[model samples]
Target: MAHWNFSLLFGSAVLWAMLIPCRAFPTGAPASACENMLPVHTGVQPQPTRAPYEFLLSSPSFLNGQPINIQILGPAYKGLLLEARSFGSNAALGIWKTPPNNTKFLQCSGNPHGAVTHSNTNLKTRQTTYTWLPPNSGCPPVVMFIATVAQSREIYWTNVKSKVIWKNPKATCGAQMLTRTWPAAALLSSMLLILLVYL
Candidate 1:
């Protein structure tokens, strides 16, 4: 009888342990996530299938020092991290506006507000928004938005990406892709129009 009781107790403990979640990031993503852009849920791989969420950019183009709003839409998720990078470079670019309720900013690679991540792990939310402020002058002509979304500890997606967003015709590309977003750009357009009319 004594042996049976001990066996039952041990089984119960194991069951309880299995029930508990492995929440490494109970508050938010760790600082280590900055470089890898990956969550700390070690041993678990991001889902190979397509992510259910999508990034909706408020505008197709953005201006220097100007902000563009990006929203994640789709199935409910537990945590997420978002970053913006120049089209070709792996480096994250731009800062973010203050994080909204239940969200926080993650600084990556010396860039303040370089990234944004979830503040609450229990909140299974379907949507979130972020406002990105691109570099004032020197930045790529096009920006790419990437993210990691976790539906649960074991279920998540990495390398989530959005379509390339263009820099406003009024804002010059700092590097990567150079463009003349100055008064001369407008003057050149006017010149082209006049040339077309004459021809």
Candidate 2:
């Protein structure tokens, strides 16, 4: 009976010794497992939260040589800085002649919609407008803009995306290309699914 007890105790000690390393190494959590299997998440940081100060624009797309207005019509954002930028073919509207002061216009052509106050509370409603005069004709029929917000105290830059809808309204610019949605939708859905799985 004494020999049998010693053998059982030795076995228990070995089992615990093996488990101790797993618990102490901290390498088996789901996150660690994912990190081991996948590349590091590398991309731009997320835009700050707009909360009540949402972007309002005239159209969802833009056309060459056409004038479009961008309105920041919403509540004030506390502890936040707003920035507007144009990318793709229509990028010229904002970054063309002269880029706005980085400190002031948020890189837009003219004035920024707002300088929201950051707070634990909700954002205030505010409004501003930016008119984009499209470049010469034959530019991409559709472009995009990124309106970003920076958290005052932190290094977080939150952004809201706007589709610079291009249209000749009068159809004088030539045959226009219709915007497609399937590709964007598919990409977004896939990302959401991955996020859900991780969560």
Candidate 3:
């Protein structure tokens, strides 16, 4: 009886150890996390101490429709959620231009590219670069980068904000490839008609 109990307890312990790391946040943070910017690790609290992470922008100012390079600097971390925003606003701004390897964007604030998060929690790195593209027309005079860095499943820092960057007043917002007058669907239909006639 004692031996059986010992084996049962040992198995349970090993199972818990294996599950604790992978189950909570293996794939990535959930879409629900967009609102509060909180991880789904229920009951686990964020670190009160300052985040070791910081942002390194390619330039102090950004231009519309152009890519701005952003780098996260610090000791290696397991995962992160990064977003560009106005100083006092919670909504995420801009679109991600080709996210880094092992990462993907989350649809937050109704924007398809609202926030960027790691797609693979197993890959840990200190230096990762992300590209952000501001919308062509709507932009505040200044924008900031905010992020939540996770060192592990239970250890993370939230609301890490960078110094604001001004928008270039002389920025020439690039011409959009598509517009309301010439929607993408209409273009697709035209191509199909041409193909059918040729066939």
Candidate 4:
């Protein structure tokens, strides 16, 4: 009987120990094990970024009498309003944010307070360009055009700056494309005619 009681106690103790580990290993041990293990990822989404229109005119410049051609050299930025500001000239050009006209002049509004504009025909380019012909004869007191990109409701915001220069016709015109030369005979004949008339 004494031996049987001792064996029974030992067996019961082993059974309890085994059962405790079964419960602890699955629930208690696994809870901590999982906690230490790599965490579960919810999901991966793309983070929002800056707007494309932030840099519309990579190089901006103006010609006192001619025109101002803006090159949209950066990634395509459509649906953005472009406003050209000529500060020293004290002029404001407000252009709608639209797909680059490729080569189309900025339309001038008829409103008295309307912003100045470049002829639609003049704004032509193979690349994306916002063209504006500054008024000639009397250049703006201080002309500086600003192309502002409008912000969308999305995560992006608008950006603007004025680093453009004044590109004079002299700089853009080719040397070979100069005015035609008058014939020597025609010049002499005209001179003789003028001299005869004076006499």
Q: What is the C-alpha RMSD of each candidate to the true structure, in Å?
A: 10.2, 21.5, 11.0, 25.8
lDDT of 3 by residue, 1-199 (tens): 9999999999999999876755556666778787677887766889999888788898899898778888888888877888898867888888997778878888889987988988887665656789998877668889999888888878999998888888887776533356467789999999999999999
Global fold similarity of model 1 (TM-score): 0.73
| Top-lDDT structure, candidate number | 3
- In order, the Cα lDDT scores of the candidates are 0.81, 0.41, 0.82, 0.38
Model 3 clashing-pair count: 0
TM-score of 4: 0.35
Point out the worst 10-residue segment of candidate 3 by lDDT: 171-180
Off by over 4 Å in 3: 1-23, 172-199
lDDT of 4 at 175: 23
Lowest lDDT block of 10, candidate 4: 24-33
Clash statistics: count for each candidate: 2, 27, 0, 25
Badly placed stretches (over 4 Å) of model 4 are 1-61, 88-126, 150-152, 167-199
Extract clashing residue pairs from model 3: none
Which tens-of-lDDT digit does each residue in 98-171 have in candidate 1?
98778898878687688888888766454566888888757777888999988887898998898898877788
Q: Give the better candidate number (1 or 4) by TM-score.
A: 1
Which 10 consecutive residues of model 1 have the lowest summed lDDT?
A: 18-27
TM-score of each: 0.73, 0.37, 0.73, 0.35
